[model samples]
Target: MPLPLYLLAVAVFAMGTSEFMLAGLLPDIAADLGVTVGSAGLLTSAFAAGMVVGAPLMAGLARNRPGRSSLAAFLLVFLAAHVLGAVTGSFPVLVASRVVAALSNAGFLAVALTTAVPLVPADRRGRALAVLLSGTTAAMVAGVPAGAALGTILGWRATFWAVVVLCLPAVVGILGGIPAQPAPRGPAGGPALRTELAQLRRVRLVLVMLLGALVNAATFGGLTFLAPVVTGTAGLDQWWVPAVLVIFGVGSFAGVSIAGRLSDRRPGLVLAVGGPALLIGWLALAVLAGEPVALLVLVFVQGLLSFALGGTLITRVLYEAAGAPTMAGSYATAALNVGAVVGPLIAAATLGVVAGHRGPLWAGAALVAVALLVALPCRQVFASRSGVPTGPAR
Candidate 1:
């Protein structure tokens, strides 16, 4: 991949850290702002909601802008939002800042994905996306934990300040590293919103989007409540939670690395293997939640399957929606966040009816099973078009 792609990855890492760091800081934020912890949790939801709304909106608005310029602009907005968050004392202001930051983050990622793919050959697009998305996995492994530690030492505000500082290098990289590339246009030689929408109407493309949502829902549904599963069910010490999370994060990184290599040549096969693996992992977790050793091993495997499945789903979407790369990329962002939001809700609801921490695992298993079924038809599609040009579908 090109240096500009790595630069884009850096920006993604910074934004992803900001997105996930809030989970660790919620208690501190509640204490400082004199709000309930549940209320403070709304900040995470607000950020997700912003992403769901902003992805398509921002991509549409910037459809005619240069990709480099758009990325830089989004990063600037993100930086400003982090600054506002760090300095603000009012709870509403903090929430607003999160929404603004998420909007910018979503816009940056959509534009960045669109920009990064064209920088390499068509066959390498899957690997290129993996390089960009590895930033998010890196954030999970290093950035979120580091931000939490910083928040513990210097207060929650300091975490946001740290994010602001992190943004500087990404900004410089975006400005200096990326060359100006004209925004993509339709065959008629202009930005075609109608054409993009029409491209999204295809059955295969819609199925890929649905698959993305379902797989993410499965992953997050179980993961959102993983701390409880570790401490409550597995009988591990609270401190062990971090270690388990680190294992999962490392596994995620590994999974993405492997998936990137295979997705170009065998995307459908990756999905076929990964989706069922995820289902089995979740089922195993549900059945063996009481065994710490089993729980630990399953979590790592689950993380691997989750991310590998993610890479496959995204590659499929990009292939199916090649006619509308920018819009398709934006929609992928929105779909994933939509799943992120819904997954936790489903898991939370199941917790009341199902026994113990097994609830989330069972819920996740069901979601992944559905996703596997949905992905069945796409195998032939991928096999038939292995090296074919993924231009706009006729």
Candidate 2:
């Protein structure tokens, strides 16, 4: 991998840390702010909601600009938001900072993909993409857990402060490491947003994107708040929370690698397999919650499969939307944010009615079913174009 790609990865690492660290610190933030845990959770939702709104809007704004400059600028915006978040005293102000961070976060990922694609050869696109995106999983594994630990020891506010401290070095690293590659200019500059939106009308392509989003969102929606669910219902020790999260991160890391390799050859197979694997994992977790050993083993396996869909699905969407790849990435990002918002809300709601954390597992299973149904239409659509059945992309 090139130095530039690694710099991009650092930016991604920062985004991942900033985005996910909130969940681990939710309890702390709630207590300090003198609010309910639910209110603090809105911080997570606000960020996701920002991503949902920001991805397309920011990507569209940069349509005519150079991908390199846009990516760099977004990182600057992201850094500033974190700085504000750390310093802000009021809760509403903190949410406002999150919204700003959200815009930067969504824009960074969307543009990063767009920026990265042009740097590599066509046949090597999948591998290059895998390398760029791996940073996200790495953050899940390393950044979030570390932040959680920091919050536990120091203070939740200090965690945000720590993230802000990371940004200074990150900004410098990105500027130093990334080369001056000129922005890509299409034959007529860039296509109009209207033209890009029209590409969605291709029934098969749009369907696949939606299916990918549904699957991606369905898994994350529940999984994001798994810590709270487990802590509340399972009656686990507080120290165990970080350990459980670290286990999930380990699964995520392994899943990204496996998913990347498989997607390069067999995207459809990975997606098909991932959905069932995740469903089973959730089911196992629900049934075995009482048995500490069984629950841990099941959740680990579930975590591996739960996120296995990310790389494969992203590649699938990229290939399907080759006509307008950046827009496709944006659309996918929007689905991701939509899922982020919907997942926790669903889990919270399910818990409200049901007595145990089982509600989330059942809810996730239902979502996986929806993802599969959505994928059915998409499979037929992609089959005709690629002249490949529901096997591997290779």
Candidate 3:
């Protein structure tokens, strides 16, 4: 990858770490904030809500702004949010900080996503996207686990401070790497804001994005309370949490890495194979919740299957949103965060009703089952159903 692309990845790494590290810190956050673990998990939803709204809103606001300036501005806001979050003792203040951080993260991601595409050839767009999103995968592999350790050794506040520090490199990278000029206007020399928002009305586009959301819902639902699952349900010690997370992250990185090679060429087949496999993995996880060894192994398997399916869904979403170049990344980002919002919310509710950590496992399985059904008319399904034209929606 080019140095500029790596620069973008560095920014993405910071954003992803800020977004996903919460999964590991929920317990500590809850204890410190005088809230339930489920309540602490709401911080994830808070961040997702900001991303859901901020991606498009901030992208639109910055559409005519210089890429380098807008990116730098976003990073500054992100850094400030983390500082405030780290210093505050109020849970509400922390929640508010998460929203602000998410807004910045969302804006940074939108610009980076659009900018990264133009830096690569048309045929290699998928590979380029993979490189950018690999920051996310790398966050899972390195950042989240490291943050968990920091929180464990110091406190959750230290993790927040760590994020503030981690973002410094991104700020410097954006300033030095992205070109200092506003995005070029459309071919007709007109802003495409109207055209961009109109793409939301396209049923095919919405449904494809829905597929992306449901898959994400499944992943985040299980992920939000994963620390508790590791220590509580699986009977593992608290210290084992980070190691288990590392195992899952290693699998997640590998899964997405493999998807990079396969998804662009055979998204349908990737979905066809990955969807069912992930669902089965979820079921096995719920059923095997009592076995510490099984839980550890299943977490790895689940991470692999989930991200492989997720990458394919995201690639398909971008394909469907091709008409909205400036907004394509926002739509994809929204789809992922939509899942993040709904997943933990529903999974948290399940915690009250279900017997143990199995609730999220069940919820994840059901969500993906719906995704599979929603995508029934997609390539392999319709082809299997006989003599139907190919499509990605119901």
- Whole-model lDDT values for every prediction: 0.79, 0.71, 0.82
Q: List the candidate 2 regions with Cα displacement exceeding 4 Å.
A: 185-187, 381-394
Q: Residues 189-232, candidate 3, lDDT per residue (tens digit)?
A: 33378987898998777877888899999999998889888888
Highest lDDT: which candidate? 3
Taking the tens digit of each residue's C-alpha lDDT, what string does model 1 give over 1-394?
7888789889989997888776456667888999965466567667877888888898888777788888889999999999999998999999899899989988988777777766778888789889998998888788877776777678889989999999999999988988766555544534378778788778877877888888888777776667667777898875566567777777888888877888888876777677777888999989998999998899889888898888777777777777776677787888787777677667767776746667878999999888877667656765643443433211
Could you arrange the candidates by TM-score from highest to lowest? 3, 2, 1
**Which consecutive 10 residues in model 2 have the weakest lDDT in total?**
385-394
- Show where candidate 3 strays beyond 4 Å: 186-191, 380-394
TM-scores of the models, in the order given: 0.90, 0.91, 0.94
Model 3 worst lDDT window (10 residues): 385-394
Compute the lDDT of residue 273 as modeled in candidate 3: 88
Predicted candidate 2 versus true structure: per-residue lDDT over 1-394, tens digit per residue: 6677778877787788888777577778888888876677788788989998998898777666666677778888887887788777789999999999999889878777766665665545566666776677677788888888888898787777777777777778766766655544343545556877787788766666666666655566556566675577677876666777777777877777787677656766776677777777776777767677776777677767866676666666666666675575677677667877777677656765654556767677777778777676556443322422111110
Q: Judged by lDDT relative to the true structure, which candidate is superior, 1 or 2?
A: 1
